[model samples]
Target: MNPNDPKTITDAEWRERLTAEQFHILREAGTERAFTGKYDKFYEDGEYMCAACGTRLFISAAKYNSGCGWPAFTKPADDETVEEHRDTSFGMIRTEVTCGKCGSHLGHVFPDGPPEEGGLRYCINSGALEFVADGDE
Candidate 1:
């Protein structure tokens, strides 16, 4: 599937392409346990892409340990790569981040973050992403 146009894929195709857990989080807007994600503590230099559509969402340079129990980044690789929406679930108002290509739920973006760095925390799910090491890409 082309990362630039994931909406072309049908729901059945998404179910067939992703695992149960991935489908739950990416498609159903579910979240993984805090601090349990594979990339929560991962600090290797790399680029993080949308697991479903392979859209480049973040980079190692922007990744930071915010003690938020998830992979946090100061910013995405490009603003256009992610789409933010006002989420009002669970009695809380928050901004939900999704892959611009496929509209898959990645996580949320919070205002609390290192002020020195953009002051935005991109709390992302590892299951929603796939990493490609700097040199391996």
Candidate 2:
């Protein structure tokens, strides 16, 4: 690992950097209850960043009303910003999305998105993201 890599951050340090909810969702791969997230119904122009490592993940324009009870995006701002892995947890087979910089769990991706937007939905947890509204950069 590289020096000062976010992935190398210790749990104790993370506790100091994030709230209990954020640590649970980002580090423990926990999910917030559907429709309870702050960003679920948020619609503004800007970027969504990883709550843990602050890595830019999605753009506001990609957001859509998937009615999945969480914030949904058509695509990531950049494919390299996130990493996908085969997740078989909770007795289900799914693709888990993680932060490329720190390996924090964001959420899962599904193939049932809007067809005009390539048919992929990045179902993310609100606790896993921080929204930076447009012009607030």
Q: Which 10 consecutive positions of candidate 2 have the poorest summed lDDT?
A: 1-10
Candidate 1 per-residue lDDT over residues 34-93, each given as its tens digit = 999999999999899999989999999999999989999999999699999999999999
TM-score of 1: 0.95
- Which residue pairs collide, candidate 1? none
lDDT of 1: 0.94
Among these predictions, the greatest lDDT belongs to 2
lDDT of 2 by residue, 8-127 (tens): 888999999999999999999999999999999999999999999889999999999999999999999997999999999989999999999899999999999999999999999999
Instruction: Please tell me which predicted candidate would have the highest TM-score against the true structure.
Output: 2
- How many clashing pairs does model 2 include? 0
